[model samples]
Every structure is written in C-alpha cells, then in structure tokens.
Target: MKISPSELISVLAQFNPWWRGGHIAGLPAWKRAAWHELNQWVTQPPVHRAVLLSGARQVGKTTLLLQCIEDLLQQGVPAANILYVTFDHPMLKLGGIDAVLAAWREREPRAEGIEYLFLDEAQFIRDWGTWVKHQIDFVKDRRIVFTGSATPLLEADQESGVGRWHAIRITTLSFYEYLHIKQLALPELPPLRSLRHLFDWTAPDFYRVTELAAPYTGHFHEYLVRGGFPQTAQIESVAQAQRLLREDIIDKVLKRDMTALFGVRRILDLEHTFLYLCMHDGGLLDMTDLCSNLQVKRPTAQHFIELLEATHLIYRLPPFGYGKDVLRARYKVYLADAAISSAVLLKGKNILDDPTALGVATETAVFRHLFARYYAQQVRFTYWRGKQEREVDVVAEVGGQIVPFEVKYRTQHTGVRELKGLMELCQQKNISRGYVVTKALDDFGLLAGTPEGINIMRLPAPLLCYWMGEAELHGVVE
Candidate 1:
C-alpha cells in the first residue's frame, strides 16, 4: 500500500515539528556515553563521512540519533534545515529516503544552508548502501547520520564508503552504564594502566585493589539478572522485567525483525535454535547436538545461527588458532546480553544464588563488556581449549600478544592447577600475565615455575567489568 505524497508530507511535518518555527523536542536526559563520540563527529570541522550508528535491537540506536539531533538543535543548527525520518514508518515505504527529502525540499525551497539528515532503521530502505553513497556524493554541505539493525549494511557501505561513511557501533549498556542508570555509589577503584591489563594482580598493590572492590558484590549479582538493556534495567520486579524482555527484545527479534529483515521462513526452527542457545548461553556450539535437539537439518541449523548473529541477538566466538582455519574450529555461542539468558532460562530470578547459572552468566557479562568496549577495534576475541578439556573463557589477541581470561565465579582461592588453560596458553604464546575473573575474591599474585612462568591475577569480575565500561581500550590495544 503506497502512501500519497501528502501523507508523507504530513508525517514529515510530525517528525520535524521544528520546521514550522516551533521548538525542537527536548531529548532524553539519560544519555549513553556513546553520544559523546557522536557529538565529536558532528562538531568536527572536516565532517565528510556519513556517521553510521549500528547496534542490536533496543540498544538505544534510535535514542542516540534523537540525542544527536537534539544536540544539533541546541548548537544552533537551523531546525528547518534538519530532516529526521524513520525508514520503518509505513508511509516512508511509499517513497524512499531520496523522495521524501525531495518532497521536503519542494515544501521549503531554501538553498545555501547546511542540513542535518537522520535516517533511523536505515536497513529497511532498499539499496540503502548505494542510496547513502549517492547522497554523500550529490548532497553538498549536508551532514547525514544513519542508524540500522543489520550488519551486512556495514560491509556494503565499506565497499562504497571510502571517505564517505564512518561507523560507530552501539551495544547494550555496559556494567558501568548499568550502575550509572541505577544510581549506585561506589568506592574508588584502584587505578590501572590499561583495560587489557586491568586485572593484572601481579602488581604489588593487589590487596588494596581487592579491598576497594569488595563492596559491590550484591550489585554484580543484580547486573547478571537485569543485564544492560536500558529499558529493562530500571524495572524493579523480576517477572515484569522478564515479560518486557520476552515481548520487547526476544519476540520482536525472533518474530518481526528476523522475518522482515532476512526473510526467515521457518521461524519455529529459528525459535527452537534460539531457545537451545539460551539454555546453553556461554557454551560451545555443537551442531550435531543442536540438530538432533531441534530436529532441523544441518543447513537449517547453520542458517538459524547466522540469522541470529545478523540480528545481533547472539554472539559466536571462535576458538583461537595460529595460522590455521579458525572458522573450522568449534565456536562458543552466547546471548547478546546476560539478561536475555536470564529472561529466557531463569524467568528473571537472580542467578547469583545458583552456582551453575551464575558462572555462565558471569562470563556472559564479561563477554558483553569486552564486546561493547573493543568490538570496533582490531581485536580478535576467541576462546582457548587445550588437552584434557582445559579451557579459557576469553582469549583476546591484539598485535600478536595473547591475553587469556578465565572466568571462575567462585569466591575463594583458585590454585595454579585450576588455571591450567591460562598457564598453558601463556607458556605456549610466551606471554607473562593472565587473569581470572572471580565472584568476590581479588587475590593477585604470581605462580612461579621452573625458570619462569605467567603471573596469575585474581580480580573481582564486577569491578573489572565496571572499569572496562568506564574507559576506552583502543589506545591500549594498539
């Protein structure tokens, strides 16, 4: 059902009320820190590229776009010159981005002024990459920002992007952001050199660090169940949060977004695969078992997994290998947020009391932190599995240096033997230090070996995740 031009004009008027000599709507005050970077790109002098903000569903990409527009309005960008359109609007499908903008221009023909155009849910537009690229080439003195759900648009834009598009990914809230949202007060954490080596308890100041971070034990527990999606973060009741998570996050992605975006026909198969994933959130992906469990063909199982990743509902981390086919190795799959797992599996009951779920959920929280923080960088996040089934949860490889992180969610002393995977990987890679994220213990010291060996650092997971969210790791990784 194509909409008439007058209908689009009416919708455009509603979207850009400021165009009619009225006040711009005030943006939400609870801004994500990612907005700071967007402001930098907007205010920078040589703003050539279209700023692209991409993230999973409900991670506040649309809110971030509105915040950016609000900032522009506050900075004296002419309201009439700015255009904000959500591509998913039914009327928007009648005419594409170019047509709507053309109609807006026809309504108010004013040249010699810079315009800021924001297109939300840009993936809905057909041939969006080419259209965006063309806009960059033809539109002069115009700053454009696009927010999308799918990631393939990234690859397409990269091919034609050249100096025309800069991408910034927005993930669910980090642990620190969660804290900020909850308004929790915390004691100062012991200073660290960089995020990569933040848990380096090999340092002599380990005792002081442990004492400082021990107070937030309960908060970390809540974080695992609540997770970091801004919408569900504030809901006090567990069941209520789970309901919203199912209806808002899971159902939307599985029912509407996947079908609309990827043309997924067997939604039941996709739902089954996702349920299996939720049950085994931070575990290895065994397609043989998954196929048998879901009663789907191998290709169907693989298709479901790929589609899940495309919609940003899950993450698939490959095993670490040197100069070999890493893709062929077994992969560890996890829900995009810890709360998703809790909502689907635990029904929003706090997992900290349950040892089994707590361990996996803790690792899920750690992965979310690293993912939200370092995904834009040139870091390869993989897991390490050695002989005798010794494994490290996360192995971050940057510039030929390997940092193995083991998640042992116990609040006691973990012996050297328990760190077999971390020790072996450090020895194999000739690295010095490794970390174990613990539930509460902050024990940090070295395990001396014949001649020399890697230092074993035990740090609190909550503090580490919080610090990671607060700082940038790109400079340290380089």
Candidate 2:
C-alpha cells in the first residue's frame, strides 16, 4: 500500500540515523577499498555520471552506501542535501524512484546545496535506469549513486546508462582483507617485485617468499571454508556461518532474486541444478550430462544455468579460444563463493582436515580470487583443459599476453610433471612463463623441455593467491 510523504520521511529518518543528531549505531566498519572509491568520486570535481554499485546480495552494498552518507555528512555537506532512499522498502516501492525524489523536493524546496542521491537496491524501481538518466540529463547539479543486487541492474545499466555511469563491483573480501577484518596477525610480506618474480623460475626469491607466507598458510584453509561474504567471515562458528550462508546467500538468491527477476517456474529444477553444480565445483560441465542427470530438457537446463550465472551465484569458465569458437568448448562451473559449495556439500566441516576436499576447495578458492582480480578490469580469465583429462585452473590473457596457472593443492602433486596442462598450453600459445600453485612447495626452477622447447615456472599457491589479490590485482595495499 502507498504511504504518505510523512510516513516516507519517517522511514528515511530511521535509516539515516545521523539525521537524528547522532552517528549510526552498530554500523559495521566499511571496507577500505570501497570507502576510498566513494571518497574519490564525491570529493573530486563534479562529473556528469552517476556511480553504479553492484554485487551479490548481502555483500554490503547497502552498508557501503550508508557509509558514504556518513562520509558526506562529515565532509561539511548538509544532512538535508544527502538523500538516502532504499527502493526495496515497501512504502518506497509503492511510489517509485520519481515519486520518492518528488517527495524529497517538496519537503525542502528551497534547500540550496549540491545534492547527493543515494538509491539503494535500485533494481526494485521499474525502469530505474531511464529515471536516473532523465534526472542526470535535466538536473545536472545532483550527484546520483545507485546500488543494485547485480541481476537486473547489470542489464539495465548497459541499456540505459551507457557512458553515464561508473560501475563499481563490491565482491567478497580477499584473503588479505579477510585477515584484517578478522583481526588476524600476518607476518611481514615481501615486496611486490619479489612476489612477481615467483612466476619466473630463474628468480632467486622463492625461498624468501615461502618464509614470508608460512604463517598465513593455515588461514587460507579458513578462508576457503568461510568464503568471502562480509557477514559470514565475521561469524566465529563454522556451523553458524554455513547456516547463514545457506539461508542468506543461497536460498534467498534462488527463491527470491531468481524468481523475481527471471520469472522462473519449477524452481526445484533450477535449485537442483545449482546444488549439482556446487557438488561439482571446479569440474568441467557437459550440458548433455547435466541435462540427463537433472532429468530436464536441454533448453530448461541451459536457461537455469544462464539465470544462475546472471545472478552471480555461479561463474562459468570457458576454454581459451577466440570469439565464437570459445562458446563451443566445454566450460567449467564454479560457485561464486567457496563457502556455497562447502556449506552445501561439506556442511561447514573444516576442509583442511580432509585432503581430497581441501584440494577441491583450494581450486575453488583460487578461481574466486582470480575472478575478483579481473572483475572490473579488461582481462579475460579462463580454464585450460587438454587431452588426456589434463587441466589448468586459471589462464589469464591481457593485451595478448597469456599467463597459464595450474592449481595443484595436493602435497604430492607439486612436481613439474603435475603442471603438464599449463606447460602444454604455454608452449602452444608461444608464452614463455607459467605458474603452478601448490600446497606448500615454494621452490621454482626452469623445467627444461625436449630440444626446441621453452622453460616454465612453478610458484606456491599461497603466495600466488595472496599476490593476485594484494598487489598484482591493484586492489590491496602492499
């Protein structure tokens, strides 16, 4: 039911606790990276575009927007000039984005300052992109920032927000960020140049690198199980975290987001496919096999997979190839969060205690960290599967430079022979260097091939994963 403007203002007052002459009580600390970006966008010279913030549900999109509001208030911006509206609120939903803005204008028609519009869960407003475009086109003084759950907004922004929005994706925390969030102490890390040299077999930094990362090895196992969701990472109990993940992340995405956005009928089939995909995390997926196993038609199976991917619940990694040919190759499916798989399949059990499970979870974790590395960048990351069932976990290509990486988490598989897939791909692509991510083997050396062949390098998994998120990816502080 539609509520009056007075009720709407009351709701706004509740969400913006700072408007009540005090700071927001119990506001969780915001991520440094997100805070920095918002600060840059706000304090800089006025730009003509709105900043589109997108991520999976419960990844702290709302919290980040609230923190931005707090930041603006602290920076001498009037509280009245900052408008924070949650589109998903039932009362707000009844009036839509335009009506909410109109109400705010009516409340203070003569307010004379540069206004900030923070629209949270903006996908709930129908045709939000068109409304935002209209606002920015006609009312150029206002700075508009909107957050989406990543299902509809991604598509909407592409259609209506072209060249008018700066998109920022707030993914789950990286292992480095996870450490600081959990208050865990890590030893001093080596320099970024030394870490990058680990990818070169001829470099002499392998021993020092292992020594630097030794203290954080055990925490990697925890990161894999806990995954990177902000709230789940904060929970101390594994079982409790898993339960919350299953309910807040998994079930909600499937039942609420998928249905509302995709008009999905027979949700059980879609859910079953998701569960199956989680069980086979990081494994090659054959559509024919999946269709038969799920007892659904090919079209239905394809639709379900597409919907899952669009909602950011899972990611499909295809084989490296050019253009349309890449679509023909079989792809591997990975849960967006490692904990989604661990929560469903292992029931919050510590993966470190189980060797086989640990290996699989490690591969999933590697894919996630790599995904975060290139999420907003122009790089394309894929998996390489060769004949004889050989495979590499991640193959990244940027500006025609192909870097193949293999994740071999088993203690026994850190030898040169285990990186056959990466080496073969590197040779075929004419790339000189490759990396092998291992459990603990930190030594790197040139693996001499037959006459007329090139040498490849192997690096430790812990160091590579940490470096990928920390320095190599440009998101972490060195």
Candidate 3:
C-alpha cells in the first residue's frame, strides 16, 4: 500500500511538536553519561559523520534524543530545520525514509540551511545504512542522528556505514546515575580518580570513604534488584518494577525483535538459553551440557547465544592466555545487567538472603561497571584460571599491566588464603596490586605481608561499585 505525502507529514508534525510552536514536555531534566559524548557529536562533531546510538530496548535512547531536541530549541535553532521522527510509528514504518523526507520538504520548502534529523528505531527502514551513507556523502550542510535497539548498523549493514557514522553504545544507568534519578540525599564524597588510585590510598583514606558511603548500603541492594533501566529504576514496588522489566525490555527483545531482525524461528529454544544463563549468571559456558539440557543441536545452541549477545542481553568474556590456550578455554557469561537475572529468575528482595545468589549478582554488577568504565580505552577483559581450579573473576589488561580482581562477597572476613587466585596471579605476573570485592563494610582495607610485596585491597562491593560509577560519570582518568 503506497502512503500519501500528507499522511507522512501529519505523523512527522505530531512527533515534532516544536514544529507547531509547542514544547517537549514531561521529561526529566537529568541526563545520562552518554549525554556528554552525544552532545559533543551533535553540537561540534569532530568529523562530518552521522552519529548512531545503539543499545537494548528501554535504555532511554528515545529520552536522550528528545532531550537533545529540547536543548536545540532553547538554543534558538529554527524548529522547522529539525525533524524528529520514529519509525516505530506504523504510518511512518509504511512510509520509507525517502517518502517521509519528501513529505517533510513539501510542507517546509525552505531547505537552505543545515538540517538536523533525528531518526528513531531506524532498523525498521530497509537498507537504512545505504540510505544514511548516501545522505552523508551527497548532502551538504546537514546532520543526521539515528537510534536503534539492535546492532544492525554494525553487523549486517556495517559495510555501507563503515566511515559514515560514529557509533556510541548507551548502556543501562550506573549506580551513581540511579541514585540521582531516585533523588537519594546521600552525602557526596571526594572523587576517586580511578580504580588504580585506590591502591595508593592510605588507611585513613579508605576508612573515611567507607564511612561516607555507609548511607548508600541500604539502597544498594534495592538497586541490584531494580536494575539500571531509567523507567523501572524509580518504581516504588520492586516486584512490579521487575515485572515491567521482564515484559518491556527482556520479552520484547527475545520474542519480537529477535524474530523480526535475526530470523529466530525457535523462540522457545532462545528463551530457555537465556533462562539458563540467568540461573548460572557469571558462570563458564559448557556447550555440551547446554545443548543436551536444551535438547538442541550444538549449532543451534551456539546460534542462540550469538543472537543473545548481539541484542546486548549478555556479555561473553574469554579466558586470559595466548592463542591456543585461549582458544581451548571456556567463555564466562554475564547478563548485561544484574537486575536482569533477578527479573528472569523471580528473585526479589529474597535474593539478598541467599548469600550465593547475592554473590553472583554482586559479581555481575562489578563486571558491568568494569566493562563500562574501561571499554572506551580498548582494554581487554578476560578471566584467569590456574592449576587446582583456582580462578580470578576479572583480569583487565591495561597498557600491558595485568590487574586481577576476585569477588568474595561473603559475611566472614577474607584472608590472603582465600584470594589464592589473585595472589598467585600477582606473584606470577609480578603485579604489585590486586582487589578483592567483599560484602561487609568493615572488611575494607589492605592485606599486608603478602608474598612479592603484592598489595591486595579488600573493598566492599557496594562502595567499589559506587566509586567506579562516580569515576565513569566524571570521566576521571588514571
């Protein structure tokens, strides 16, 4: 069915209320960390390339775009020059980009100056990459910003968008952003430059920081269950929030987006694979066991895993080693967010009661923070396992320096003996510092008298996450 130009223009006008002398309303003033990165690209792009924001659904991508539009209006930019349209709308979906733009131009023929176009859910448009590339190459004095819930821009249609667009991933809110959104009045502490700087902190510094962050302890557990999605983070009821997360974020990606974008025919198999990952979050992947338990072939299970990762539902961490050894080692998987596992497995506040479950969630949270913090630096994140089944949870290779972190989120006090994996890795690699994430606030300090003069700092998981989140928000470098 061919859609008429008048029909498309009506949809565009509704989306861009400012075009009709109205304003964007009912949006929060606060912004995510990605806002800083995005603002730079929109206002003063270093190069003349379009910007693409990609992430899982309900991560507030649309909200961020709306915020940008509001800012531009305030700057006194002509409202007609800006076009905000989302393909999610059925009418717009029927009217492809060319038809929509033609309608827009028909309504406003003054296309003489720079035009800013914000396209939402652009993956629905067929050959969107080629279309965007053509705009970048042929069109002059025009800027384009698009958003997608999937990674089609980088995967299937990447060749067309190779150098035409800059990709920025918008992740779930961090603990710091979560606190701000919840409007918690916890006292702010001095910023710690980076995770590496904690090694140089004195005894008093550690004690002072821990005391300052004590007020956050009561809320950290709730944050774990609620997760970082802005929409669900503020819901008063934890169960209701988790339910919404499952329905809105998890289910949409698994049931609808997977089938539409990736040709996933066996939805049951994909759902079961995700559920299994949730049950064993932060565990090694055993392909044979997973295939047998799911009653699917090896290739089918592998394809499901790939689809999950592509949709940003899970993260896969390879083992730390050279070529052949790394190839043979099993990959450890973690949900993109801790709250996801909790939502899927129906673990609410009761999750905190189960130490084992709590530990897994905490480790998953820690990995997410580390991944977000160092991802921009191109740092390689992998786990290490030695003889006797000793293992380090996360080993970050930064500028050829190996920093090992082991999560021991337990009530009892941890000694050097329990951190055998961290200690052994430090000794073998001649690294001077390591970290152990603990459960109790009182367990925050350095473990002295270790072999090879290694300094292992035991930090509470909540405080560590808070500081890491803070550092990321501030863009503090080591």
lDDT of 3 by residue, 1-478 (tens): 9999988988888888887799998889788878888888988899999998888889889999999988888987788888888988889998899998889888776445689899998888888878887999998688888998546656757787788888888778888889989988887877777666777788899888878878887788888999989989989999999999999999999999898888889999999999999988999999999999999999999999988888888999999878997898899999998899989988788888998988998999999988888887888999999879999999999988898989999989889888888887888888888899998887888876688688888888888888888877777777
| Model 1 misplacement above 4 A | 21-26, 45-47, 155-158, 161-163, 190-205, 322-325, 444-451, 473-478
| RMSD of candidates 1 onward, in order | 2.7, 2.7, 1.4
Clashing pairs in 1: none
- Order of the predicted models by TM-score, top scorer first: 3, 1, 2
Of the candidates shown, which would achieve the greatest TM-score relative to the real structure?
A: 3
lDDT of 1: 0.78
- C-alpha RMSD of candidate 2: 2.7
Candidate 3 residue pairs in clash (backbone atoms < 3 Å)? none
Superposed model 2: Cα runs more than 4 Å off: 30-32, 45-47, 108-110, 156-158, 193-195, 199-204, 441-455, 472-478
Per-prediction TM-score: 0.92, 0.92, 0.97
Tell me which of candidates 2 and 3 scores higher on lDDT.
3
Candidate 3 residue runs with Cα over 4 Å from true position: none
Which ten-residue region of model 1 has the weakest summed lDDT?
Answer: 442-451
lDDT of 2 by residue, 1-478 (tens): 6678887777776766655577866666646456666667766735788887877778778888877877788888877687888877888888777667777766645357789989887878888678777877888778888887665776766667776778777777777667768887778776453334544433455566566678888787788888788898899998888888888888888998777777887889998999889878888888898998999999899989888887777888888777887878888888777778889775576567778778887787777777776655677888877778777788888656787777777766355566667767776778776666678645444444422555455556666667666653344432
